[model samples]
Target: MGISQSTLFRELRRNSSPAGKYIWFKAHDKAMERRKRSTGNATLAPN
Candidate 1:
């Protein structure tokens, strides 16, 4: 955690559910999905 408290809070806020509960699996899925979309691949490696 080199990040500041506010940065951590912002990430949690972004990945948290609309109902305002944090589910670990859902958050991980959301992150992976976003990663895929942003990189155009399932992982970070280039084609």
Candidate 2:
């Protein structure tokens, strides 16, 4: 179908705290940071 359960779980696992808590706000920040990082690298790579 669409996104798989495993993919969602993997993202949650990666974004979780060291103590294994999934706080949505922190996860959102992490996701945004990751997006910016990937975008930066992609832009730089074209040079």
Candidate 3:
């Protein structure tokens, strides 16, 4: 099935904030992307 409607709403409300979830998400995404790019570059470098 899927997430219950009430549970989804509760999570949205709980996580919502003017200075919270979205900022953290963007920061985390940027960090992960930077790490992946660095790792890929290292692998492709000539020894």
Candidate 4:
């Protein structure tokens, strides 16, 4: 809740339901899915 207003607005736009409603559980699931997808794209380079 300490996030900036712009950050909050961005998340709301990103995780809002199809009906344009914001639900905590749905938003959390969406965020988790996005995090998982992003992490999957990270690859470590061999030293």
Predicted structure with the largest lDDT when compared to the true one: 4
Q: Can you write out model 4's per-residue Cα lDDT over 1-47, one digit (the tens) per residue?
A: 89999998998898899999999999999888888878465678999
lDDT score of residue 30 within candidate 2:
92
Global local distance difference test of model 3: 0.63
lDDT of 2 by residue, 1-47 (tens): 48999998998899899999999999999989988878453334564
Clashes of 1: 0
Q: Please give the CA lDDT of all the candidate structures.
A: 0.88, 0.87, 0.63, 0.89
Checking candidate 2 for backbone clashes, the offending pairs are none
**Stretches of model 4 off by over 4 angstroms after superposition:** 40-47
- Model 3: pairs clashing at backbone N, Cα or C within 3 Å: none
Cα RMSD, model 2: 3.9
Q: Worst lDDT window (10 residues) for model 2?
A: 38-47
**Against the hidden reference, what TM-scores do the models get?**
0.67, 0.64, 0.35, 0.67
TM-score: model 1 vs. ground truth: 0.67
Candidate 3, run of 10 with poorest lDDT: 15-24
lDDT by residue for model 1 (1-47), tens = 79999988988899999999989899999989988878464656778
Candidate with more favorable, higher lDDT: 3 or 4: 4
Q: Candidate 4 overall Cα lDDT vs. reference?
A: 0.89
